[model samples]
Target: MSDLLRRVATPCIGVCSTGIGDDVCRGCKRFCHEVIHWNSYSQEQKRIIDERLDQFLVQVMQDKLHIINAELLAWQLGVQRVRYPAQKDPYIWLFQLLRAGAGQITEPRKYGFVVDSVWRDSSLMELREAIDREFYLLSQAHYERYIGRYMQKEG
Candidate 1:
């Protein structure tokens, strides 16, 4: 029995959140009753628990992949408009990227007043152009046009 116990062992990540009263792990969804009786359980029981855990992790990873793919599709559509545009303003699609940047900022003042005003405007295309212009100017590496100390030299 001892040899079997040693051979039928499983791995634990030690983030035990098995609910005290619920009889199930709040963190990993493993049953608390199974956990409490882990030593007494058969090898087959442990295998079933492990399989269930693997399935749960796979679902979590798949959901993340779906979200990432959706964002990429939206970006690709926006890019295609820029590359082969029949309209006067091919670059108008870039406003979505700028609006996205505004949302990602942790601090409000980092991007400057022009960006802030664009975010406030009703026209999404105009807002996108404003952001693109800002990006182009900044990419030139000039500090004069920039609001603050733009890209300081590393020590």
Candidate 2:
């Protein structure tokens, strides 16, 4: 589908932590206001939000993983029926695979990636948590630097 015709999918994985009043959600790594207002956002707004998230995941994975085979990664995501946005950066697809079931994967090579040498020894489950933690923190930092600053100035 064309970008204009296609809707940007919500990042929610059904593990929302925003109800407890978190500034950023743990599941999708979106700011709390973003989650609450997602359905109301215009297509362009949604796309911007999605892009920010994709960039965050890409940043977190940059040092920790390497996609050596883009074709294989695409094929594996399809073969495994991983739910990811098509036509996105391959790193986003890699993040989706990790989010869906990192532990289920034993040899990332089969999925077309190799964990960095430093993280190769870590269990995929552990790696998944670390990635998630970093992503959330990064989102939180951005929110504080931008939104929070705006709010503080306005208040």
Compose the digit string of candidate 2's lDDT tens values, residues 30-132. Answer: 8988999999999999999988998999999887999999899999999999977768889888988987888799889999999999998899889888988
TM-score for predicted model 1 compared with the true structure: 0.33
| Candidate 2: Cα lDDT at 141 | 96
Off by over 4 Å in 1: 1-11, 66-155
TM-score of every candidate:
0.33, 0.91
Candidate 1 per-residue lDDT over residues 1-155, each given as its tens digit: 35235344443435555544533443434555566777887787776665554444434323221222333434554554423212212122223234345344343232222223324443435544443344333322222233124322321
Counting clashing residue pairs in each candidate, in order, gives 1, 0
Best candidate, TM-score? 2
Model 1, C-alpha of 113: deviation from truth (Å): 37
Name the lDDT value of residue 52 in candidate 2. 95
Candidate 1 — which pairs collide?
95-128
Error (Å) of candidate 1 at residue 84 is: 46
Candidate 2 positional error at 101, Å = 2.5
